[model samples]
Target: MAFEPRQTSVGGNIRQAGERLFAIVEGALEEEREQLALWVPVAMGMGIVAWFLLPNRLEWLGFCCFSLAMAAGGMLLPAGGRVRQAIVLGGILACVGCVLVWGKAMAWGTPPLPRAAFMEVTGEVRSVSAIPAQQMSRMLVRPIDAPALPRQIRVNIAQKDVPEGLGEGAIVRFRARLMPPAPPSLPGGYDFARRAYFQGIGATGRALKPVKVLRPSTSAPPLRARLFAHITGRVEGPGAGIAAALATGDQGAIAEEDAEAMRRSGLAHLLSISGLHVTALIGAVIFLLMRVMALSRRAALDWPLMLIAAAGGALAGIGYTLLTGAEVPTVRSCVAALLVLGGLALGRDAITLRLVAAGAVVVLIFWPEALVGPSFQMSFAAVIALVALSEHPRFRAFAAARDEHWLRRVGRSLGAMLLTGFAVELVLAPIALLHFHKAGMLGAFANLLAIPLTTFVVMPLEAMALLLDIGGLGAPFWWLTARSLDLLLVIAHGVSASPWAVMMTPTLPTGVFAAAILGGLWCLLWRSWWRWAGLIPIAAGVAVMSMASPPDILVTSDGRHVAVRASTGGMALLRAGAGDYVRDMMAESAGFDGEMSALADLPEARCSDDLCAVRLDVNGRAWRLLLTRSDMLIDKAALQDDCASADIVVSDRRLPPWCRPRWLKADRRLLWRTGGLAIDLNQGRISGTKIASDAHPWIVPAVRNRKARSGNQL
Candidate 1:
């Protein structure tokens, strides 16, 4: 009887504690409901992105339309059912997202090339830009004669193959063999083909002959290109490339080693014209204009000088956007800047969460596909984090101090930069790890030095140099800009060389990244102790990612490159030196050494002229794999040897009939149908998965068309 009473008392206390926790959570949620409600569209946008990343395509376009209609019907209901209205709104927005994404996929998927072949094409050169850090150039040509190709095809030409004086908007003819865009390099790797589809690029090829300029061109190259040329011509060294890259968004002249250093140090963003550069330019222009106007007492008194200054800042942002060719990042930044300026004109908070949400919604609606890209993810993550950080009490208190001295202001500005870097890295780390499988551990420290130098020194000099070049006095500005760039390069190299600089990690599952994003947003949106609940998913995601394992084998799409995990837990190349691109992809994905090791160096992999073999242990089961080429297929001795010894045979030719029922095999036919193959071995059983198959535009045009036609009926 005493034990029963004690147990009852403990159980009652536990129930009371649970009820208190629940009440606190409920109150926090209720308090945050209104603020969280605004992100419905943003959540819908994320849903749309998720739909795109799904492995298998679903016919949900009609269902999405139906849900949207149902949502519209909910709005007509009486206002009493607030909970019902919220549910209806969320489901409807999610449906709208599905519809928009399906529509974008269909729009971008305009019948991939019917076949790959050599062709003679004559087209107008829409634009020409140098391949990054390479002497070659990529020309966007709108083909007039090639009816089977996309409206615009990207043609790559060697510097020598480009005809003299050829420029943008020039009508030209070239003979080239075009192929459809390369498929995903790995299973669920970056989809260049999908990106190409969205970019209106269906075909890519190398020019077989020099481009022949057809007509007498009256117009000059594009304004951006002309500026690039003039700047490169005047600045005569490697730094000239960096100068042009900053001024005009052309990184073609940057050295590959220097670029890698920047990437390793996480300073690559400086090379790209983005939010920081745009804001600096606009702010500088605005400050100068306001000062100039302030000097004219009569004019200042007669006009709304504040409004005039805001308008001028907006205009400067627009001009700089145009100067950079309005790339995606530039356009996004410009939109945000204009939104802030518009808010100022309306006497509202310029950098409120609502303004950021509105800008994000607009960008998502117009460019739903961008959500799949690393740039959009990284860019928005940084912005969202910074905006949230700006709301903290410490920052607010610092900003409210208006009468601060200049020295104090400088100190605060430096402190703010460090905080911004930390916030951005916090948000972008998981995202970068998920997409690129790499992160710069020391990126924050690197950016502390790089950001201020680029912002206050490099960009200013570049801007001044552009202006002075028109008057033949640009040499000094360019010299100074070059010096700053050299210093930045040195810093990047030094930082990248640090022992704890770059962290190459294994691939992270998409679900982990999505969970991390959700947790981050939840914490950012809510202001309560209950917000700590968001950390659960974040911690879970990191735990899962840390446990990720590498694939046992990797085979390229063309069966030209093969890598297998050795018994010692390192990747061993079956072939050396060929398929460098594929090699790099596998190495990075598997979290092996960054460089592809020679077959001879790996003790476990033995190679001959026609064959290479490696042994892999998965779940303590031995898997013997043979990597061979076409010529080895016809050699009965080699085939017999392979069939007898190997558990999995990966070859460039069809397996001989003798080996069909004997061992599992992947050959040219299977590989061609499915872009690439990854095999998993467990407990003496073998199974394989392909990168992708007929769902791709080039693979199943007929099926895609049928699906599109049937989509309207759900």
Candidate 2:
């Protein structure tokens, strides 16, 4: 065929369509400029306010350093050689400067603190994680600072220790030395230090010896402790507290089962008090109150009423945030909502891209660490996606069609919801998976149902509770809502049970996900269609998986212990017992079905179908083998023979410490059954065969040292 000159016609049509699209976007951008300008400064101001309000309050000195750094970073911004590079580089340096300032302030402020050696320190538990409210514990600790060392030591218990009954707000002093957290016992397992780094915990008191709580002139109460206590006390109803949690993201009273349900159902954001909660509150309150006002002729005409309701909603949002301890997510959501709502109240407009950017810059300046958190990314992503997708002029075309049928309106809502979910998840998923290690395959589906429920059902009930409490009849509402919550949980559990609900554990490296998210963001925000480039990071992530060298052992931080999971094989617990959450995390991450297997299974899950046992004889000692759930055992007589024949015998457990497997719990291979006259396998491999001990063994440094803790006094 001749070269198709006919394509010339299509090309013109495509160019025309592109021009029209560009015109539409340019118009919208023009409309948004004013709103953007006003919000930018307001949000920036609030961020500064937060910096002043945030605890670990380092006023002048820290502020000076940050101001200088921001000024320095400002230089790179105008270079304009590369926008993305500038933003990234400046953000990184700013973050580093802030972290340094914060760390220094934490270390140097107040009483002269001393580093505590584990051996020298005698500490007492201040608090531990007995509930979802506080994930970890605080210990009243002292440092084992002697002649050679003079560093302040603080110990944080992995789990919460403060009694739910005693409450965290109480002030107490520990007369003990603090020890830093220890690293994980196994290579490629969880990195405790890294986890703590993210968590902002500096030291741990795992080896602390209990000492009397001193009443000696105590210091000021910790901000978190006071905040936790205040939140716990405010909401007293059964579901009222939980509802308040959803309303305020103050999970001080929410049950763990509910949290699990939310996670399984992909509604975890509901409890986060971030974009989801704030958006729902803003929309629901605005729509309802505005409608109520619009209905009344007098109220409709009265701008005062509209202002009052908007103010009410804003106040409610702020109050809820305070109750939740005003953590980073709530603060961001509140600030964002405040900007939009303030714009509306001022008759200005809505938030614009410039506004979002300015708000982000200011927020980062204050809580620079938040720039690296999911809240910062997801919150901004969701907001920007909503603005871009919802404010399209094409929505005008649906106006005529909506008049024809009610179903059309509902359908449009659903469609909008789906579009929003897709847009935001597309933006947030990469980072979510990278940081969290799992992606909800059907989070969009779950969130579709959940969004309306939260807006319509959850928030309404919580609002009503406050009113009912004033009338002394909150119990009824609480009981009624609790049942409704159960239904939501059932839905969550059911959806979670669906095979497609959640993706299997997948590897998500840091930079790769960051790249993907940035690409998606570029696609979403840029006037260019190149946002489709978001696919690059996703593809990179997928490609990485093919050659992914997953940690040999997988571990999760539960604020208490690191749950060990196996990716390929060769995973074992160093200690005899681990917490339930750790076990569950290990099982889930490794895709094990609660079996003894590590990956897809722990090391010893033979199941009821197989019953095998063995005893190894080495150096005249018979050692029983480690049996997972498998009905495997060693022969008494044969064990004796092997012991006589071999040099060193091995058992999975420390049977009086003599027969202890010299290797870590999961390191040893299955030795053959001592008394096997049974079973045959086609392969040469046997689950019960004696294997050579690994030659180049790994030795993890001991996280705890009894000798080190003892100081000159000891």
* Residue-level lDDT tens digits of model 2 in 520-590: 65555654444466667667766764454333233221111222333233344322266655555444444
| Residue-wise C-alpha lDDT for candidate 1, range 451-546, written one tens digit per residue | 889889988888898899789898999888888888888999999888687666655667888899888887777666766888999899878777
Task: Give stretches of model 2 more than 4 Å off.
Answer: 1-179, 182-201, 206-241, 252-257, 280-315, 391-401, 546-578, 585-714
Index of the highest-TM-score prediction = 1
lDDT of each: 0.74, 0.48
Cα-based lDDT at residue 615, candidate 1: 66
- Flag regions of model 1 displaced more than 4 Å: 1-30, 55-58, 62-82, 394-415, 629-633, 661-663, 680-714
What TM-score, computed on C-alpha atoms, does each candidate reach?
A: 0.89, 0.61
- Model 1 is weakest, by summed lDDT over 10 consecutive residues, at 685-694
List clash counts for every candidate, in order.
1, 45
